[model samples]
Target: MSDTTQMETGRFALNSLKMLLVVGILTLVANSIGPETGFRAGFVESIPGMGLIVLIGLVALLLGRAIPLDLPAFAYAMIIAFALALPFSPVQGPFLGYVERVDFLATTTPILAYAGLSIGLQTGRMKEVSWKLVVVAVFVFFGTYFGSALIAQAVLSAQGLI
Candidate 1:
């Protein structure tokens, strides 16, 4: 590879690391001050869990870049995280305990905000798309939501939790 290309790659990796650290800090703050009283774990207490999450995300990003396929980093991250947290995995106990300390909603807030901002910035591109695409997106989102709710209800009922 050319020197310029290598330099750019190094810069990109550094930027990604910085972004992941910022996200970890944001998630820690959000988790510490979330609306739910039960989720008020102090910021200091949540550092290890959040750091682990960021490290996993960084590993996933690197893996995605190393692999030739077009799959996104989050996909690889999910697979890796799931493997580590599986019941039979050697790291399952500590992994789950630390991860569970990080509230799910806290992690999603920044991601959703980023998604919204990106979509907002692309409104002109979105307008260029056929209206049918919007309709399809709505239906897909609705179907996903309904399916998730149904599955949640069934699971809760089975467990006598609802």
Candidate 2:
């Protein structure tokens, strides 16, 4: 379309790529410093897995922008990741092999930190909301936590793993 619109689109894409790269690096560092392995060993071993994860995120971001729907980029990423990891999928073997190198806790660490920072920054706005909303959010969080624990316990018991 217009030259200005094209320039803005290019700028947006470049910024998105930069943000994703930062996230990838942060995630790699988190994974590297985990308790199970030394930093050098973990960092070297997890490079391929982390790279694939970031690539999937980049593809999902592009897909989200290209599609007309209002779905978020993370939703697209989840779908693509899930599909790749499915047992019957063609890429399942290599996908799982690479993905398994990255610990689950490593990924959640950065995400949780970001979420906490976001909430901290929004505290002023949160104060403007009703107390009832805070109460509801507490209950929702509690229920989700308890429900997940119960499900995990049941599954572990059924599998004779606990």
Q: After best superposition, candidate 1 residue 140: deviation in angstroms?
A: 5.9
Provide the global lDDT of candidate 1 against the true structure.
0.84
Cα-based lDDT for every prediction: 0.84, 0.83
Clashing pairs in 2: none
Q: On residues 1-162, what C-alpha lDDT tens digit does candidate 1 reach at each position?
A: 123444455676788899999989988888887876554467887788888988899889887777868888899999999999888999999888777788888988888888998887788888688989999999999999999999999999999999
Please give the range of 10 consecutive residues that has the lowest summed lDDT in model 2: 1-10
Q: lDDT by residue for model 2 over 73-159, one digit each (tens)? A: 899999999999998999999988888878777888889999998898788898799999989999999999999999999999999
Candidate 2 structure, TM-score to reference:
0.71
